[model samples]
Target: MQANIGTIDRALRVVAGILLIALSLFGVIGLWGWIGVVPLATGLFSFCPAYRLLGLSTCKRCQ
Candidate 1:
């Protein structure tokens, strides 16, 4: 599969994921906060199935 995510987007995902996980861990937020796992996974993997299905790409160099 092609890489469709941009560097800045990936970086934001990673940062948001970390924040969500941290808040969830602290019990200040609900379990739903753990949903950050999605961004975390996608950020690490550098691929988003939804983006692929929707024909959306944020890559700087798409071909």
Candidate 2:
């Protein structure tokens, strides 16, 4: 899939994802922390299914 997520958004997602995972690992949060995988995967893959469904594209070069 094309990258509909921009650089800043991707970075934020990655950071948030990592933070959530870390929190879970450290027992600062519960199983919900696993949800971080969503953002992490989307950030790493540069694609978000929800964004596609919403018809949003933040990519600098989208065709």
Candidate 3:
């Protein structure tokens, strides 16, 4: 899939994802923190299925 996430968006997602996973691992959150995997995956790949479905893209290049 094409990259639909912008640089800043990707960076935020990565940071947020890492924080969530870290919190989960540290027992600060819960198993639900594992959901961070979704953001991590989408960030790393620079693609978002939801954005695709909504016909939206944060990447200026993609637009």
Candidate 4:
């Protein structure tokens, strides 16, 4: 699939995901922290299913 997520967006997602997972590992949250993988994977791939379904794109001209 074409990339709809930009570098900044992906970076944010990765940061958010890492934070969520870290919180879980540190006992700051429960199993919900595992959900962090969603953002992590999407960030790494620079594509999001929800974005695709909604026809959204965050990629700039650089992409």
Give the winner by lDDT: 2 or 4: 4
**Per-residue lDDT tens digits of candidate 2, residues 23-59?**
9988899889989999999999999999999999787
Clashes of 4: 0
Best first by lDDT, ranked: 3, 4, 2, 1
How many clashes in each candidate? 0, 0, 0, 0
Against the true structure, whose TM-score is highest? 3
lDDT of 3 by residue, 1-63 (tens): 889999999999999999999999999999999999999999999999999999999999888
Pairs with steric clashes in candidate 1: none
lDDT of 4 by residue, 1-63 (tens): 788899899999999999999999999998899899999999999889999999788988535
Q: List the residue pairs that clash in candidate 2.
A: none
Top lDDT model: 3
TM-score of each prediction: 0.91, 0.93, 0.96, 0.91
**Lowest summed lDDT window (length 10), candidate 2:** 54-63
Error of 1 at 6 (Å): 0.6
Residue pair clashes in candidate 3: none
Candidate-wise lDDT, in order: 0.88, 0.91, 0.95, 0.91
Q: Which parts of model 1 are misplaced by more than 4 Å?
A: none
Per-residue alpha-carbon lDDT of candidate 1 for residues 1-63, written as tens digits (9 for 90 to 100): 778888998999899998999899999897988999999988888888999999988887864
Error of 3 at 20 (Å): 0.3
